[model samples]
Target: MRLFIAEKPSLGRAIADVLPKPLRKADGYIVAANGDTVSWCIGHLLEQVEPEVYDPAFKKWSHEHLPIIPDRWQLVAKRKTSKQLAVLRKLVKQADQLIHAGDPDREGQLLVDEVINFLGVSKEKTAAVQRCLISDLNAKAVKQAVSKLRSNQEFIPLSTSALARSRADWLYGINLTRAYTLQGQKAGYNGVLSVGRVQTPVLGLVVRRDQAIESFISQPFYEVWAQLETLPEDGPVERFQAKWQPSKQCQPYLDEAGRNSSKPLAENVIKRISHQPATVMQLARQHKKQAAPLPFNLSALQIEASKAFGLSAQQVLDVCQGLYERHKLITYPRSDCRYLPKDHFTEAKLVVAAITFNSGASKAATSLFGTNSEAFKSVDIGVKSRAWNDAKVNAHHAIIPTQKKLNAAKLTSTLSAIEEKVYRLICRNYLAQFLPAYEFFDVKAEISIGTGIFLAKAKEPIKVGWKCLFPSAKPKAEADNTDQESEQKIPNLHIQQGLKSLAARLDEKHTSPPKHYTDASLLAAMTGISAHVSDSELKKVLRDTDGLGTDATRAGIIELLFKRGYLRRQGKTIFSTKTGRAFVDALPDVATHPDLTALWESRLTAIHDGLSSYQELMMPLQTQLKSMVVDSRSVVPHGLRGLGSKAQYRKKQYRKKRPRKSKSSAKV
Candidate 1:
C-alpha cells in the first residue's frame, strides 16, 4: 500500500478528493481502492526538547538550571498534537510505501522529516519513501505530483538544514529563556521573561525604532509656497503652487518690536514672493513610460493586501494558504520569488479566463492582451533571464493563479477580502506583463515672478497601458467633448505665447516627521534597505538579499516579538515596551544588528549551495553566542536599573563553592 502524507489535514483531504479510485477512510489515514493511503501531520507532531527534558527536576524554574544542554537532542511529541502523532505511527506501521506530501518549503520539509523520524519506520518495512512536491493543489497538479514522486533521500540536505535550524532555535530559546527568567526571579521579579533567537532580534527592531521616535528632537524646518492661477490655452482657470528657491534660505526682516532681525525663512520667503505676478518663462513636455509590476510572492502579497485591504501579515498568509490548500485556486503560499516559471505560460490563459468570468478586469485584460489564447504565446515564453531563472526557484515558483478552472461557486462565499486582494494581485501582474507600458507626457512649465522663478507641472497620459491593471491608476474622469477641456484631455501649449496669469497667492507649509512604519512599510524596510554591518564585504553579500527572514518565517518572527512583549499593536501601530527598549539598549551591537542576520543568511546560503560545510558555517555563530553571553554577564547590567529599587534588584551571581568536609569525612 502507498501512503501519502500531506502537511495538514485540509491539504490531505483536498488531495484525497481528486485521487483515482474509491477511497476508504482509516484511522487518520485515507486508503484508496488502488491500495494507496493518504494521511497528514497537523503542522509539526514533534519538536526539540525543552530544558526540562535534561532533568525532570529542571522542569521547575531555577537559576541553578542556568544553561541546560543535553548530550543528545531529543524530539518530544507536541502535547496538544500527540493524537496526530499516534495516527502517523499507526499508518506508518501498516504502510508498504510512504509518500511525503508536505508543503514545498524548509518548514514543511522539517515538519515531515521530524514526524517520519519519530515513527521509527525502518528501511525493511518500507518499500520506498517518495516526495510529492507540489505548488498548486488543483486536481491535475495534485494527481501529477503523486504520480511522479521522488525519493525522500534526494532532499536530505534541505531536511538537514531544517532540522539544524529547529535544533538551533531550541538551544537558543531554552537556554536564553531560562537564563533570563531565572535571573529575573532571583532579582525578585515575579514575571517570566522569555527570549529566542528570532524573537529577540525582532523585538530589538521595534525597540530601536521606538527609541528613535522617543528621542527625536524635531527641528523646525520651513518651506515657502507661491500659488499661481493660470488660464490654459483651451481650458478654465487652473491654480498651481510653486516653492521659492534655496528653500532653506530666508530674507531677513524687522521684528514686530521695531527691532531689525533675521526672521524665519518661511515668513521671509513668502513675503518676498507675494508682491509679483508670475510670468510664463519656459515649458517642456516629454513622454514617460512605466512598466508593469512583477507578480506576488508571499511577502509582496502580504504588503499589498495590508495596504489595500488593511489585513495583517498573518491574515494575508492565512488567506493565501487557504486559497492554495483548501480552495486550490492559487499556487504555493510561502514563496519569495516573484517570477512565474516558463511552462506556467500555458497555464496562464486558463487562470486569466477563470478570473475574467467573474470580474470586469477580465474583459479589460482580454481586450488589452488579445484574448487568453493569443495573449500568452505572443509574449516572451521560455525566455531565460535573471529574473525568470529556474535555478533560483526552490520547491515552488512565485505564488500565482493555477490552471484549474476556479469554481465560481467555491469562490462566492469562501473568498475573503484578503483572498480577493491576493487574486487581484496575481491577476493584475499576469495581465500587466503582456500589456503596453504606460505612456504619459510630463509637462513642466517655468514661470517667472519678477526675478523669482516659479514652476507648474502636469501629466497627460497618452495611454493607460499597464497602469490600467491598478485600480488607482485607471482614469475616473469622463471624456471632454466640449471646447472647454479638463486637465485629463488638455493639449500642449507654448509657454511664453499661450500663458496668461490670472492671480497669485503665497502659501506656507511646514515639514513633518517621517511617518511611522506600518506592516507593509516595515516589511519593505526589512527587505529593501542596506541594513548590513560596517563591513563592506558583508554589505555587498547582503545587497539585494531577500529579507530578514523567509516568507514562511517572517510572520512568526513578528508574532514572537509580540509574545515576548517586545512589540505591541495599538490600532495598526506597533510600539515597543519599556522592557523591550531597555533590552535593545542592553544588547551588544551585533545581536540586534540586521547585518548579523544577513551574514548568517549568506552563510546558510553557502551551506545550501554546497560551498561550505554546516559545521564551519555555524562555528562563527556558536563562538559569537558564547562571547556575547560572557561579555553581557561581565558588565554591571544597566537593565537592572529598570528592574526595580536597587535593594531587590541586584542578586549576586550564585556560585557553588566547595565546603570544608565536616567531621563526616573523619567519621567515614
Candidate 2:
C-alpha cells in the first residue's frame, strides 16, 4: 500500500485526481483501487505545545516565571484535526510506501514533517518517504509532478529552517508579549500591550511616520515656467512648456533638494527670462523599452489589489486562496518568487487560451482591456519574455493561471465580484509577457534662456506594446510611471534652434509631509524596509531578505495590529492609534527595529540553504530572551497612561462567553 500525505484537502484532491482510481471516500482519506491512499493536513494537524504543557508552574504570567523556555519541545494533535490525525496514524502503519505532497515551501515542508514525527512512524518508513512538489494543481501539472518525486530527506533542511522560524517566533512573541502586557498593566493600561517579532516593528513604522508628519514645518518653494515658442523654421511656429532649472551659480540660494528656497531668487530668474532669446542647449531623444511586470507573487498581488480596488491585504489573500484552491484557476497563491520556471514557457498557449476564454469579463464595461478571447487575440504566445528564467525561480514559481479549461458560467460560479477583478488583473499581467515590449522615446531638451537653464521632458510612445493590455486603468499601473512626472508634446528641432520665451510663470508650492500609510504603501514599505534602517552593514544584509515577514504572514500581521487596537483606518489611510503610538514609543529599539528581523530571516534562509544549523540560530535567541524578561521587571512603559483606562483581566477570564438570544443581535 502507498500512502500520500498532502498539505491540505484541496491539494489532496488535486493530487488524488491524477492517481490510480476507482477511488472511494474513506473516513478521513481516499482509497484507490490499488490500495493506495491519500490524506491531508488542514494547514497543520499538530502544533507546538504551549508553555504550560512543559511545566504546570509556567502557566501564570508573573515576573518570576518570566521567560518560559521549554527544554524539550513537544507537539500534540490540534483538537479540531484530531480525527484526521488518527486516520493518518492508522494509514501510516499499514503503508509499504509513503509520499509527502506539501505545498513546496518552508511552512508546507514543516507541516507534514511535524505530523510524521508526531505519528511516530518507523525509522525505515520515514527514511523511505518520497516528496512530491506540486505548485500547479491542474491535471497536467500534477501528473508531471507525480513523475518527478524525490527523496524526502533532500528537503530536511527546508523543514528545519521553517521549524527554526516557527520556534523563534513563538519564543519572541510569547515571552515579550507577556512581559510587556504585564508592564503595561503596571502603568495603568487596561489592554494587552502585545508585541511580536514582526507586528511591533510594523506598528513602529506607522507611529514614527505620524510623528514626522505632526512635527513637519511646511516651507515654500518656487519654480519658474518658461512658456517658449519655437521659431518658424520650414514649419509653423509651435509652443512648448519648460521648467526653469537652477544653475550651479544659484547653489547658495537653493535648498538641499536643489529647489529655489528664496522667493527673490526665483523672481529674479523669472524677470530675466521673461523676454529673453531661448536657444536649445541640448536636444536628445533616447529610445527605451520596458518589459511587462512579472506575474503575481503574494505580496505583489496584495499590494496591487489594495491599490486598485481599495481592498485590504487580508481580503486580497482570501480571494487568491479561493482562486488557487476552490477554482483551481491559479498556481500556488503564497509564493514569493516573481520569476517563473523556464519550462512553463512551453505551456504559454494553453495558459493564454485559459485566460482569453475561461476568465470572466472585465469589471469596468468601458475599459479597453476585457477578458474575452478577442481582447487577447493579438497576444503572441511564442514571444517569451524575461519572466521565464530557471535560475530565478525559487521553491515555488510565480502565481499564474493554470491551464484548467473553464467556461464563463463556471468562473462566475467560482468567483465573487472582487475575486473576478483580482483574477482578471492576474490574467492580464500574465498575458502581457506575450505582448511586445512598451517602446518609447525619452525626450529631453535643455533651453538656454538669459543665463538660466530651463528643461523640458516628454515620453514619446513609439508603440503601446504590453501597456495596451492595461489601458485606462483607474488606479494606474505601477509600470506606467508617466503620470508621476511632468511631460509635454515635443516637436522636431535642431541644435541652436532659435525660440522666444512667451511669458514666465512663477509657481509657488509648499513642501508636503510624507503621505500616511495605506494598505498598498504599507506592504511596499514592509517589502523594502532596508531603506528605513540606519546602519550600512545591516542595510546590506537586509537587502538580501524580504524586510519583515513572509508573503503568507504580512497581511495577517497587519490585520492583527488592527485587531489589537494598534492601528485604525480612515478611508484608505492607515494611522497609528493613540494607544498604538504610546505602545511603540515606550518599547525598546530591539522590539521596534526591522533590521534585527531581517538578520533573523537571512539566517533562516542560510539554514534552508544548508549553510547553517538550527542550533546556531536558536541558541543565542534563548540567551537574549532571558535578559529581556529579566529587564521586563523594571521596564514599566510610562506612556501607557492617559487613554481611558479599565481593568486588566487575565487570559483565562475569557474561557466562557454569554450566548446571544437573537442572530441579528450577535456581534459579527
Candidate 3:
C-alpha cells in the first residue's frame, strides 16, 4: 500500500479529491480504491520536550542553570493529538511506500519528516519515500503536483534549517524568560517576563514610536497664498490659487533642522506679494501613467485589510486561510512573492474566468471591461506585465483567485461579511493586471510677482482604466512638504498673461508629531525594518531574509505580544504598556535590537543554501546564550517596579471596599 501524509485535514481531503476516489473513510484517515491511504496532522504531531522533561533538577529555576543547553534534544507526541499519531504510525508500518504532501515550506517539510522519524521509518526499509509540493488546493493543481513527486532526501537541508531555528528559539526564549522572571520575583513582582527572538524587537518598535510622540514639541510656521484671476480671452474669468515661494536669502521659515519655525519671515513675504500684478512666466503640462498595483503578498494583504476594513492582522490571516483551505476561492495565503511565474499566465486566464461573475466582483469586472465588449471577451492576462516575472517568484506565487468556480448566490450566502470583502480585494487586484494603465496629465504654472515666484498646479485624469474598478479607493496623500497648490485645480492661462491678485493671507501651521502605529503601519515597519539599518551588508542580508518572521508566523508573534500584556490597543492604534516600555529599558541592546535576529536569519539562509551547516549556526547561538545569561545575571528586573505601587494601592482599595463574609455563609 502507498501512504500519503498531509499537513492539515483540509489539504489531505483536497489531495484525496484529485486522486482516483471511491475512498474508504476510516476514523482518522481515508484509503482510496487504488490502495493509496491518505492521512493528516492538525499541524505538528510532536513538539520539543519542555525543560522539566529534560531533567527534574532543571525544572526548578536557578541562576546556576541560567543557560539550559540540552546535550541531546528530545521530542514527544503532543498528548491531545497522540491518537491521530497512532493511526499514522500504524499505516507507516504497513505501507511499502510513502508520499509526503505537506505545505511547500521549511516548516512544512519538518512537519511530515518528523512524523516519519517518529514512526521509525527508514529509506532502506521502505521501497521509496517521495515529496510532493503543492501550493494551490484546487483539484487540477493537486493532480499536477502528484504526477511530479521528488525524493524526500532533496529537502533534508530545509529540514535541518528548520530544526536549527526551532532549537535556537527554544534556547533563547526559554532561558531568557526564566532568568528574567526569577529576577522579577526577587524584586517583589509576580509575573512571567516572557521573551522571544522576534517579539521583543517588535515591542521595541512600538515603545520607541510612543516615546517619540510623547517627547515631540510643536513649532509654529506660516505660508502665504494668493487668489488670482486670469485676464482671459475665453469664457468667464479663469480663477485659480497660487502659493508664494520666498527667495533663498529671504526664506527663514525653516530652522537649521529644516523644520518650520518662523512666522515673521512668512508675514513679510505676504506683504511683498500682496496687491501685485502677476505674470505667468512658465506653463508646463506633462502626461503620466501609473501601472496597477502588484498582487497581494501575505504582508501586503494584511496591511491593506487592516486599512480597508479595520480588521486586525490576525483576522486577515484567518479570513485568507479560510478562503484558501475551506472555500477553495484563493491560492496559498501565506505567500511572500508578489509576482507570478511566467508560465502561470495560462493559469491566470483560468482564474480570471472563474471570478468574472463572482458574488461582489461582477460589477467591477463589467465596468472595467464592458460586459459584452471585445475588451471583456478578449481579456489579455498575458500582457508581459511586471507582475509576471519568474525571477521574482519564490517558493509560492502571490495570493490569487483559484480556477475553481462557484455559484454567485452560494458564495454570497456562505461567506461572512469580512470574507466577501477580502475575496473581492483579491479579485480586483488580479483583474487589474489586464487593463490599461491609469493615465493623467499634470499641469504646473509659475507666475512672477515682483521678486517672489508663485506656483499653481493641477492633475487632470485622462483615463480611469484600472482605477474604475475601485471607485471607493482614495489616492494616497502627498508628502507634508509638497506644495498645496499642486492639489488644487488650475484654470487655463497663457504664458506671459497678466492676472490680478484678489487676496493674500498668511496661514499659520504647526509641526505635527508622528502618527501612532495601527496594525497596517506596524506590519509595514516589521517587514521593512531592513531599509532603516545603517550597515550596508546587514541590510542586504536582511532584505534577502524575511525581516522578522515568516509570513506564517508574523501575525501570531504580534498576537502573542498582546496576550502577554506587553501591548495595548486603543481604537486601531497600538501602544506599548508601561510594563512593555520598562522591559525594553531593562534589557541590553543585544537582546532587544532586531539586528541579532536578522543575523540569525542570515545564518539560517546560509544553511538553506548549503553554504553553512546547521551545527555551525547552533554553536555560535549556544555561545551567545552563555554570554547573555552571564550578562543578565547582574541586571535588575525593573519592568514591574513602577507597577508595584499601583498594585498595592489597588489591593488597599479592594480591602476597604470588601464586604465581610456573611454570617449566614459561616453558619452554613
TM-score winner among the candidates?
Answer: 2
lDDT of 1: 0.63
TM-score of 1: 0.76
What digit string (tens of lDDT, one per residue) describes model 1 on residues 143-180? 77777788877776676666556655665666665565
After superposition of all CA atoms, the RMSD between model 3 and the true structure is 8.5
Residue range 331-372, candidate 2, lDDT tens digits: 899888888888888889889888767754534312425433
C-alpha TM-scores of all predictions: 0.76, 0.92, 0.86
| Local lDDT at 179 for model 2 | 90
Candidate 1's C-alpha runs over 4 A off are 55-71, 83-97, 120-128, 151-154, 222-287, 360-392, 403-410, 416-426, 441-460, 473-508, 532-537, 634-668
lDDT of 2: 0.81
In angstroms, the error of model 2 at 636 is 1.7
In model 3, what are the clashing residue pairs, if there are any?
Answer: none
Q: What is the lDDT of residue 523 in candidate 3?
A: 89
- Residue 43 Cα positional deviation in candidate 2, in Å, after optimal superposition: 1.8
